[model samples]
Target chain A: MYLLRRGDPTMFETFWRGPIGESATLVIPGYQTMSYFSDVGNLCWFLEPGFEREVRRLHSLVGNAAVEGYHVLVGTGSSQLFQAALYALALPTANAPVSVVSTTPFYSMYPPLTDFLNSGLYRWAGDANAFDGDDYIEVICSPNNPDGSIREAVLKSKSGKDIHDLAYYWPQYTPITHMLAHDIMLFTVSKCTGHAGTRIGWALVKDKEVAQKMSKFMEQSTIGVSKDAQLRAAKVLGAVTDGYEHQLAAAAGGDANLLFHYARRKMAHRWCALRAAVAASGIFSLPNEVAGFCTFTKDTVTSNPAFAWLRCEKQEVEDLESFLRENKIITRSGTKFGADQKVVRISMVDTDEAFGIFVNRLATIK
Target chain B: MYLLRRGDPTMFETFWRGPIGESATLVIPGYQTMSYFSDVGNLCWFLEPGFEREVRRLHSLVGNAAVEGYHVLVGTGSSQLFQAALYALALPTANAPVSVVSTTPFYSMYPPLTDFLNSGLYRWAGDANAFDGDDYIEVICSPNNPDGSIREAVLKSKSGKDIHDLAYYWPQYTPITHMLAHDIMLFTVSKCTGHAGTRIGWALVKDKEVAQKMSKFMEQSTIGVSKDAQLRAAKVLGAVTDGYEHQLAAAAGGDANLLFHYARRKMAHRWCALRAAVAASGIFSLPNEVAGFCTFTKDTVTSNPAFAWLRCEKQEVEDLESFLRENKIITRSGTKFGADQKVVRISMVDTDEAFGIFVNRLATIK
Candidate 1:
């Protein structure tokens, strides 16, 4: 059952509504994490050591990202970290603001978030593929948000900087191809453990100066992130890692009590249902399915993204989001992601009931 | 015993160290508050209803701020809310950035926080008293940060916007004279309940449009405040209010298990000790003590601010902070707060041990 409160029925749902059980849950005592400083000796003083340890352990367990020798700085979320990365990368002494670019069909928030302050430090420069600027910050979102495609940095300018948004790079969202060793990479518990409300994200920075600047930006922006959230995230991430460890000890039990396994299965099931719905509708199409050899799961797996990039084939559907809205469904417009109006991005991680309702509505659209 | 982590020895101390026992302790279950949305029906979509309810109740019980008609918007902290208020008040179409001015000897962070982004929407414009422009934003921190003096808006320009930072306005810091009905007033659990690590603050805004804009800024900046932190804040605030209610029923028993009463008594004792230390030092002077009749306490009370603004009377001590640093005590330089070099702001809310050490050091400074 969907435990939804009465409000905007059309509002997009988040992933954690499904039953993943109590292992990922956390209990924080009132007196815990009351001080602003978590580890005063660390460069990112606000970061809880336990959260950092869990983040490293999770990445190590999943074989997704390299954390060793990298500075771990916590943020409110990947959103704040994205801005912090921009702030850190931008040359303050420069005469003009640094241009920040991403590939088309980027996360809908990138543009507004970049340009919101009209900050002299950085400004949104659309489409990394079209940008020829030598000094620019390119965001590379792998297993990308809207399209769910594996990506690499498109801009190879010598003076260009890159901020790898690995928010969806976990084994559940995509294949664990290799240990990513980027200069700067962002991850969040929202996608990893479905704790979006925790507002916790961390960056693995290869450069100390950049990490310090990012930390400074956080200090200036919010006087650092919430320690309570960080503590909760630590507990949640620790539980997820523990589940994987338990699974490893019982390797023969294929779908044992593992968060990633459960999440991956759910995603796969959702994708199957969505594809079947679209085929039945005959008026909608989705991005081509991608699969790869898994390193962590030890089996070939089809990619199951957190979002379904759907394109309406009907010429009458001028605005897919509006058309869907008329049919008692809500979707983010492709135009928001710098794509054609005929396409809309549907979140695949919502509650099971919401997903079922969405698929049923889509199947009957014809 | 002080839990001093090995790090920067000169770093200033935070307040929550004294043993207040488990009354304010919160235990949050793991599965609770994982979504980004809290109260979708409210204008501030991310605000948890329980948090809002507790905030209103606390304000009503304390008679500090008028919250009846005001919109209570949650932020990562008052730091973020301060920026949000600035973002909300700044005119997008204005030819130049909105000038943000605080009085001389203001909070050390105000200037840097205001200008860090180099936002075209707002710029740090030194002291409000020196600012002659009609189009500006003025920040009023009552029972002010450095000097702990009761303050009013230094600039009364007809077009100027005011953001009342009432972070130190609680009964412990100062006497609650009346219910303050400001356009934008910011408060935080960091000061109110000694939960600096939670990074949770709420802004009581009178204007709907301004509140919405501030909320939008938060949405763009951090996506939203952490629900876990909000939940904890709600619990802490509720407990504080419960203590007051309990106190009223047991009025004959003074300082009876009330957080505010406990904090007030602690503050009173610390201030007395500090004053005695300064007098004994002969080379140091502190701001004049202020007192008023408190509506909540039902008695005349002296202001026991969170900070002791101390000035060095010794001619050799050009920099008071440096002088204190040599004495193995850390204090914020008055220069950072736009005051004279001889004046330094020392945090009075640190652990009893740290405060005791500080006072002893101060007394022997001569």
Candidate 2:
């Protein structure tokens, strides 16, 4: 019911909704991958070797992240990985819970999730820019959620650490401006290939101690991530790379089978449609468009974010989400993102039909 | 390295190590189940409808659990569901964290996992029998881990709650004593089908509000269980039911394709071998074997537990785990389960070769 009322990240469904043969299908026999330990010798004991290999291969192909020296740790999702990172960075012997801060208009779930357990190891300290504490863990979500702005860690305290949520750093959402080499970087198959139900996410950690600590947290929490999901994710990601390699071999400049190319085109079209609707409405405004030279794409490409941060121009429209709901649309209020209520975050990743209806409702809202 | 020194439940691998054709296989297409939401109308929005159906069907078939009028909430594993139950039962508005207790000789992972996050919501207070708190959560692991003792909640305080860990309460490990209708009963596919790597677990929650709270905790932790794993678990469980149905149609009483029958036979044989070895050794003792009339199998059968609670008879052998290590037979010390140091938990569910070697080593020990 909640999904019917709101648009989650189902936008990429349009591209892969139809039958595409066995390009990315996964087949598992009755007697395979039944053990809990995938690679016991590896630091992340539960991580499947095949999954790890595909993850590194995809990242290397996209040139989005540095995976050479990093240890890849799989989690149920980036959400689990985020908490694991916090657990890894927090000092167990500290007198007080370490403050976890992120910039305003951050991911709305961050605060609630961090404080959900009322954990003694860490607590949500909102707004990294406003955080005055010396001991803190700052999260930097590039091509940030809600606003689609590029970000970096604001607090540089000696005791402070950073967790880079690069969930949207893929070529379709944002340009691979550079190879991200951070202390801890997060990525997920949900945004990468729209396989949200797979619940497979990974982190590339620089420090072995932090990696082990995160893996320990995983062991304590979920035992480990699902091997079924990991194997499926590997297959899906492998298919994606196969598409690109196939295109490269043909040299036909046609991206009919390529996932990123197809997704990039769809996202670009949706962004254009949404921008036109917002401009024509005259009562709404969006963040100025940004572009960059993508190292992977080898071209200057416009940033097409997974979400649209829209602000109401009319003074009477204090709660934009409520206002949109009145117009038969739904959106998350910016208040949840630690921003003004007049601004709401609209997901641009809904199905093409849903996206069309949303834009039509927005254009006529005035 | 840790797994190398310990026997973790890998015994079921022998049954599933061979090709069983497509009986329990899972094939998923690239575009299938890409959305995060699965049966959003249900209390557990992330739960796949097919998975839920199979869970209920399997419970009815085994006559081991009451699934009607219950909300089945899935988790990463029973480990996650155990914590979820604790979270649901813990009063968030209370001034102090609720005490969590289990009987002595509890699952070894319970205490550390409960306290790992240093959660202010709940803390591990060992031994429910010794606990004197009015408001506490008691975990009852029937056909309990490490010791294989059938247990019941000892604490009946007015404000006390119970979470039944029925991971080993299956036809293979124990008889179908009754249809368990506890407030919250946890089970996992890892133990049920020996697909530990699938990492899928479910709880039959009796209360709506409690189920919702558990689902919320799941959302905050891992967002949701993996659809791929859930689908695979559903297929695997469905295959088990099919095996039994095939036998019923034939009316032959022969149980070749049935999973529980095969596993039960294997377990019973291993137990017989282990008992003979222990008796021959004359320096070790084991828990007395018990039996019950099983409704599922329609016969009185001897109890064959998944773990052997072995105690060294030698008074000088203070550390039994170290003693076993010297003999190249790895086992978990009873100290971890809050038991005497002279005893250790040996997994009876290992590969046939490994079990054969273990019993031989036991028989040779003075």
Candidate 3:
């Protein structure tokens, strides 16, 4: 039923719905790679140095984050990296399981992923403000997943290790206001290039041991990320950087920053349409957002986020997801995001047609 | 150095040296699938019933394993499946760590992977033969990684669960003497279709809860296997099965069993050459393998095996890998596989060019 309603304006697939086929499609050589090992900088499997070079080059150009003095470790996706970051930060050699915390309305994966292995190395201790702890892993999902809230580590523990998931910190998703130079920072092609199907993500780590351990975890798990995927990622990332140089003169009005500009405009347009829909419905409320000065754009820029965090306004109405589903609109319940049941998250990245249908249905939900 | 030696005659690189061009390549349709959460027959990610149908159909045509009364879960590779199997079999909820054991000269990954996370749920309990416990996971790697020996459960405890890794049970690597209907069976696209780089593998699991737990493990680790890879694997697997029906009748002398025939002959020829080389070396002893009744070929067929386990007969050649390295031939040491240092694993799957050089080097070693 879910598959049948894939684009029913009901399922808000937050992952990606971008250009594929020839543009993103990969035709791996018949005699292509198969080894879980690579000559990719003396690490574990699947990574090739050529591919890593391209990744490092892209980050350097984007200026969204610093890659220097960091071990570049790849994951099946940032979701895996999120788990790796926790695993690396919480040393088994430690006396007790490190407490993992984020502020309220955190990325849903954090708490569940932390406790999934049932491993005693780390425990999801809940809201950062409520938890009193020195040894903890503070996961900062800047330009956050569910609600599109930009945030800093709420916990002020000196002993806390911060894992900055910069998945949405790209110029297209959010303002590249600052160059992140955190201990452990994660970025993914899924959000940046909208190639979620590729399942390629990487982390830049300042600590050598933590980086090695993260890589070790990947090795024991999937051996490494897929080589075919890596090759595709390298190309896609190259194209993004190429867009920065306006390499495709025929596209984007010959603008140097084609990808970022196009994505930014598209996101902003979607946000406009979504806001108008919510306003017409008069049954939902949304939080206000502010833009930041972007280094890449050299201007104060704002982003219409990839998600619309919808909250029911009426006191009698709760179970926002169920409420929205009744109107043929699908959304993730706010409870999943550690918020109230009266709130739900509607994705802003679905196809234009689906988005139109969603806006129409949402407006009619009186 | 490893990348440079990719096509080196010393490296077998036999995993894949086949023709790869547009035909085998995949072009996922523009606006193709994304969303880590799939409606792929529930349970977990990367597994769509459409893809699972192809997998089961392939297995059925190959006469390799039983898929009935099983839950299909995909992973990054059989390596991940192996870890998942261990994790699923050893429930952390059981109040105590389950002893994970494999027989002597087991696949090198068993011990390290078992202990990687340092998870208290399971411990690497050395050799299976040495461990006497009911609650244990005994891994049986048929046509095992290091040495191509076919095997079964070394421990027969009532409370024990066995994970059968049939990675090399295909007719090309080993004779398909029987259809595996084990509790947990691990199979990979790498050895099967020589597409190891795709990082796709599946476990045919009999028990429902065990399969669900394994799916959960994959979910928390990589979220799921690469969907692109899964689609490609489905197509590649379909091609293999298509060859089984002689779908491309114009090729292979109208034989439906073209792939098997070609692969079998290639493996047999390689083995014949390998035998001659070892005989000429006069410093090594090779194990003798007999043919088994194969249902596919309808004959008592033998295998060339994917790996050559060579034992140094000379007293001076204690470190066989070092000795082979001195001769510009790279081989994995036997101690890595829990065997004597004098024994080393030589990959028999390298291309014809590399195999020839390896044969020449071994023949001249004395």
Instruction: Name the best candidate (by DockQ).
Output: 2
C-alpha lDDT (0 to 100) for residue B130 of candidate 1: 88
Q: Which whole-number lDDT from 0 to 100 does residue A22 have in model 3?
A: 38
Model 1, position A255, has a per-residue lDDT of 52
What DockQ do you compute for every candidate structure?
0.55, 0.76, 0.42
Model 3, B127-242: lDDT tens digits are 88888767888888888766777888888878888889898888877778888898898888877766767788888989888888899888777767777777777766766666
Candidate 3, DockQ score (0 to 1): 0.42
Report fnat for all candidates as fractions from 0 to 1: 0.68, 0.82, 0.49
lDDT, candidate 1, A1-366, per-residue tens: 222111111211232232333555556554566678888789898998899999999888888999889999999989999999999999999999999999998988899999999999999989998898699999999989889999999999889999999999988789888889999999988888777888999999999999999999998999888988898888778877876677678675655457778778878888999999999999999989888888988888999988888999998889988888888887888998999999988888776677788898889998
Candidate 3 i-RMS: 4.4
Q: How many clashing residue pairs, candidate 1? A: 3
Question: TM-score of the A chain in candidate 1?
Answer: 0.93
Give me the runs in candidate 1 sitting further than 4 Å from their true place.
Answer: A1-23, A250-256, B1-23, B250-256
Superposition TM-score, candidate 3 onto the true structure: 0.88
Model 1: per-residue Cα lDDT over B257-303, one tens digit each: 57777778888998999889988989988888899999998999999
**Candidate 2 — which residues are off by over 4 angstroms?**
A1-7, A17-21, B1-8, B17-21
CAPRI-wise, candidate 3 is: acceptable
